[model samples]
Target: MTASLPVAPDARQKPVIAVVGPTGTGKSDLAIALAQRLGGECINADSMQFYRGMDIGTAKLAEDEMGGVPHHLLDILDVTDEASVAVFQRQARELFDEVRARGNYPILVGGSGLYVRAALDHLEFPDTDPAVRARLEAELQERGRGVLHARLAELDPASAQRVNDDRRLVRALEVIEVTGRPFSSFMPVRQYVQPAIQIGLNGPRELLHERLHQRVVKMAEVGLLNEVAELETRGLRQGKTASRAIGYREFLKVLDSQRGVLQEEYSVADAITDTVVATRQFARRQITWFSADERVRWIDFTDPASLSHALRAVTDA
Candidate 1:
């Protein structure tokens, strides 16, 4: 049974509401419910969901699932385009204002922790030097990702732990080299740029892990391979961000096996297993990221009163 969400009182100022948590924690469903109750629009904070052809693996909501609510920022980029946090911050802030201007609450949703912070927090990015970046990229190619990551870990351990991909790893090292400052120093403070409420959904670790595995299996069953194959033709392999996505990356190995590009045959079952492992790891990282922020009000995702609890957080804010 679902608890009824309380009606939002009429007020001149509506706080920005953020639905944040790990993957497969029902963030999107809760976001839609909040939007329906609060007369709000959802602005996506998921970095991968921005890619157009990534629907199945990313678990993107179809039109019918949106429940007639306006959703922003999903499918805004092609798979080949790299996602930029600075660019996303600017665009999301603009949407926040626009949504509020129309007398609607802005509901930000996704498990991408940094993206969520960029949308709501007082964060700033350092300028990048093309020469320095080129040098670093060349170094990465020559020395390999492990070597560069080790160097970054030595320079800024916090940034090293937070950065999960080669692109971000390179960028962190670039920031250290160019600005003479640790990349972690530029991370957002807990303070929000505007009045906001963050509702976090979490459950038992075992339950979350099981759900992630089931979801990966379901995605594979529902044409995730075909989706990856189609995107590969559209330059998904060349995409610095998209190519590294959990499920897509695993499935691409199967595609390579099919094409005889690799000596070993990678099966669909192999892809599913790898994807489940990667997704669970990613979810753990997300939990760590969001849990560190004390401002987030957590509710048990499995609880029947979760929606009502989330609504109360918004109303109390």
Candidate 2:
């Protein structure tokens, strides 16, 4: 089948099919089913789902849910391990190469827009300095996020514009600590790394919001609380990066509420409701993140014909 993909100099590097969209858009289902049909293997591009023991809350697919299709990059990390985009990009490329070596199509699937973009663009990022990061983190804790963000705006307007207020401020401060240079100065020009057939599944905002709500409800039904309980029992704290994953952090607040800690008078039910709302907000941010990339071929997901149309484009090339 001809895949309508960007041209690559070598046929040895197999073409990729990236299934991307907001959370609860059925991207994983489509990618797995497609892999089953087309001799493909799926690789995760999600940031949060990598953590072990986070299955129910992260909406990570179970082994049976995978429908016997081989998958990569899921449950490969501990909660304490920090997974960076550069590291993910490198491992994802290796997985892509391995999949192609086996003569199978590589299907990349997730809602993490940054990870997807990093993989597609072959982005090169600067090395991280632990001492620098530690100092910046300490400063942020003491000085506040607004102060750091203001500093970033002065030093690197372009990077500041692209990143979220929280992450940009933290990273900008780290860069200043490390090199005494602005974070914007290290930005690399992107180079396309693969011949990829892109397909986006997007619906109206209301529909997406509803879907996100329903997905959260499903998570609750399927033992999300138990998952959080296990993590808490393992001594995962709210301040840690892994504990700060959307679901984990919110549920931790719920636990604290039980202990009379939250001053906002949150309860278990309130926590659940707020978590669902926050997840919807996260999906909105994901949409904004993906929209910034011009190379993706977008499709309105409500149309039943959209997937077929995208597949046709993939095969027509």
Candidate number of the best lDDT: 1
Give the per-residue lDDT of model 2 (tens digit) for 1-317: 12233333453456788988788788888888678767889999998888888898888998989999999999877777777888888888777777776777889999888798788785557666888777777888899877777777787787678768565567666776677776777764455686787777788888888878777778777877778888887655742557878777877787787778878766657767888888888888878877876767788777877757667756864
Clashing pairs in 1: none
lDDT of 2 at 210: 83
* Runs with alpha carbons beyond 4 Å of true place in candidate 2: 1-13, 131-185, 188-190, 263-265
Q: Per-residue alpha-carbon lDDT of model 1 for 283-316, expressed as tens digits?
A: 9899999999999999999999998999899878
lDDT value, residue 89 of candidate 2: 86
**lDDT score of model 1?**
0.91
Tell me the whole-model lDDT of each prediction, alpha carbons only. Answer: 0.91, 0.77
TM-score for each of the candidates: 0.84, 0.81
Q: RMSD in Å for candidate 2, one decimal? A: 5.4
